[model samples]
Target: MNEIIPRYIYGFLNSGLLLIKYCRSCTVCSRLTRFPRYNDPKKLVETREGRCGEWANCFTLYCRAFGYESRLVAPYGVLTLILDFTDHVWTECYSQFLGRWMHLDPCEAIYDRPLLYEKGWNKKLNYAIAIAKDGVYDVTKRYTRKWHEVLSRRTMVTEPSLSSILTNITNETRRGFAPQLLSIIEARDIEENQQIERSLHSEDDESLSLPGRRSGNEQWRKSRSEIGSDNLSSSACPVRLCVDEHVTKIYNAFRPVLHQFIAEEVTKAEAVE
Candidate 1:
């Protein structure tokens, strides 16, 4: 399922099930562009608004609908491939077969392509932290090539303080959960943190990746050689027809089946889980 997921999810996001609409700027305002905000996942699942943050959150929820463990990531850093960092959101899902978290973007329909932002789009990422009902985890290496370059800027909070806050948040959020669920979450947080530690220690470059993931640098190099431009960028997503029109078709075609599935079994599945 992990190996073949790109076939289904790639088509789902890229084929237009979830659309992408640029915010005038982003979460933070620029001299030229205004700060952009987005709809919540539940609302976007129905509305299909297509903003980046909305796409990330809704996709995380969608993965959960399929019983995949997932998280919402907020990466605050440079997308300019330079010093100015901005606020952006994406998703990461645990791959049982791969034994690590893989990056996913419903906006670009990219999976495990952390370097796509930096190498493919020429961005410079400083910090990427994932937030969930379980806990928070630093997932910067999955998206950055220059940890040393950005370490000084990552001083927003100390690791100890951040960890404490995440644990408290998870506990507060899990108020109604049974002991079993709390235990499961605690184990999950530990596992995810271990992965983060490994990432921090890894000497791999953008051309290299974790055991179960593909190389974004390799993919970008291939795309450049084949297409002559970086198509992964939202502004330049390589697809036929206008992206909005293309996705509208996918949404119309898939929505009925999805709604039917939810009506029939999603509730039961959630209860069982």
Candidate 2:
């Protein structure tokens, strides 16, 4: 239903298929944002273009404005070969379905697919944290394979030190709230942490599900690189570039699906595009 903002966020992502090319070009760098923040969804809606963080920030802002709770999440440590965890950002909105907050990546137009990185992309996950108005949340369990592997990353900060840091940051971030509510938020954070601890300790939660296909293959990675270069290859004749046959077909196939989803949602509200 339109009432669920996560769906709207997901739908908006699907509608804004601009993230596809953006990811290919800018995933390796944050510097691209400086050229233009792409921070305004209004502009992105009009232009139909933006990178991953732009998609995340815009979605976060839109969700908050539309009366839904939201947060921006980023992985904290270990973007190594084993972890293969890249520095990425996404929005998380409170979900009525799972009765807990869920992950929403606009870049991939994926909803509740934290495991997509570990399982689908066949990458490792370490520490991921969410920064929201109410409090800081450790949401790593939703993505990781080996809990023990993340222990060192978690140890980067002691419990007491991390608590103090989060408390101070929360006060600064959520200062507009009534002073009386700070303690309430703090209590909620503590409870959520305890819940996460129990959930992560469960035997079933230790390993992520494997991918059906052998993931992160060299050929697949190379194909993705070609996909990112806007399907055109740099040849000896720089001006005379050749387009990859597969990329055009794939993009054309996916483009219509993205447009249809966006159109359905737009019919319900004023559309920027």
Candidate 3:
């Protein structure tokens, strides 16, 4: 269901389908064009089209309906946009295969590309929060490699205060839930955060070479500074020699022990002689 839902949503929402932008009292309006953004899934089904906001909203609802644990991922603070309403929005469905939430953007028909916004589009993201059934999570770290830059941009609230706010919201949302369930959720959150840290620090060249935003027009993406740079070569990315480093560390740590063992063997030999 997780694999099928985004493609299912994307199947009908192609370029041919047009969103109603300008409709008059009983006819069509020509001068000004602005339509109320629909949040309800039922209304979205009727309209059959919208931007990222509507796409994410409907996709998340469908995922929940199909018994998949999912969440609507969106930015928390103010987003200064050249076009569109918010920075970007997408869905993250908990993947049984990986035992973690995977990014699923129906708009792009892209999955597991959490770095799309930051790396692909070349956008500076401040906060990316996941609004789940159990609670909300400040998942900004999962999406960006330049985490220090993202941190510097987060001037709206202090880290502790932001954490407090999210905790409060989550507690309120998780009210009446079993203590055991809450504990499980908290453990999952910690594990996920650790996983995100590992992923952000990953030295995978494939991740580093991910292309620019594939959904929007070239001009629009360029305007938003999202049209990511061309494929990065191995020379440019320079994969870290962690294996060599680890071996060297092990040798350094055990060198003294090896010398002591050799000295003990020689001393026993001298005594025997």
Candidate 4:
């Protein structure tokens, strides 16, 4: 079902679903755009179109209807707010075939491309949380390869606070779950945690040559700075010059001082020789 749903959605969407780009605009002027921002899956089915959020929402509903445990994956900014094209929404279905959660983007019709945002779109995500009926999880590690850099960017909350918050949210979400279901979910979570840990240690060869953001047009993707990187190695550690910033000035000043120190040291070495 996990493998079949993406292809089905891809074909269904390509057939006739109109992707309303203006739906993302300010809702205050929604009357001007006259776009129906439908939240209900039934409404989405009737309308048959929307952005990644809608696609993920409706697709997640479909996964649940088919008895597959699913999650809505939301990649957000450091403030935990969904920023406009910088952020994206997707679905993750717990695959019975693999006994693990698999990433699925109905918009792109791609499956298991967990690094699509980080590697494919060259996005530096701060948090990629997975929200399900039973729990909320900080699944940032699943989506990013540069854990150290990601940790550096997560400045909104401390590690313990973030973990506590997520745990509280999960407990609230699972409050209504029966003991049997809760136990099953706990076991699954443990398995997934181990899987994610292993994934962090393992190198993904496919990440070397991931394609760009295929869901949006060239112009749109370029506008969002998500056109993606063909040269993964070069783009991975982008060195940006912080012109006129305090740190930049300090770095610039240090360069010549370090150069002078090296010259003097070399001269002293020559004298010794």
Our model 2 lands, by Cα RMSD against the true structure, at: 12.9
What C-alpha lDDT does candidate 2 achieve relative to the native structure? 0.54
- State each candidate's clash count: 4, 0, 1, 0
lDDT tens digits by residue: candidate 1, 25-96:
322442232222234454465766443566677778767766788888877542221233234578889899
Provide the overall lDDT of each model, using Cα atoms, as 2-decimal numbers.
Answer: 0.58, 0.54, 0.67, 0.68
Worst 10 residues of 3 by lDDT: 1-10
Q: After superposition, how far is residue 44 of candidate 2 from its true place, in Å?
A: 4.4
Q: Which residue ranges in model 1 land beyond 4 Å of their true spot? A: 1-38, 77-85, 205-237, 240-250, 257-273
Clash pairs detected, candidate 2: none
Per-model root-mean-square deviation over C-alphas: 11.1, 12.9, 20.8, 23.3
Task: Evaluate model 4: give its TM-score.
Answer: 0.69
Model 2 per-residue lDDT tens digits across residues 1-273:
001111111113433432112112233443222123334455554454444565577667556545567898877632221232235678888775565677777555567766666555544456677878666766787666457776665767786787688778766788788767867666666666775677566555335442222212235445433112122233453221222244246545655544554557643234223
TM-score of each: 0.63, 0.54, 0.68, 0.69
Error of 2 at 28 (Å): 20
Compared with the true structure, what per-residue lDDT tens digits does model 3 show for residues 147-196? 88999999988999999999999999999999999888889888998999
Model 3 TM-score, 2 decimals? 0.68
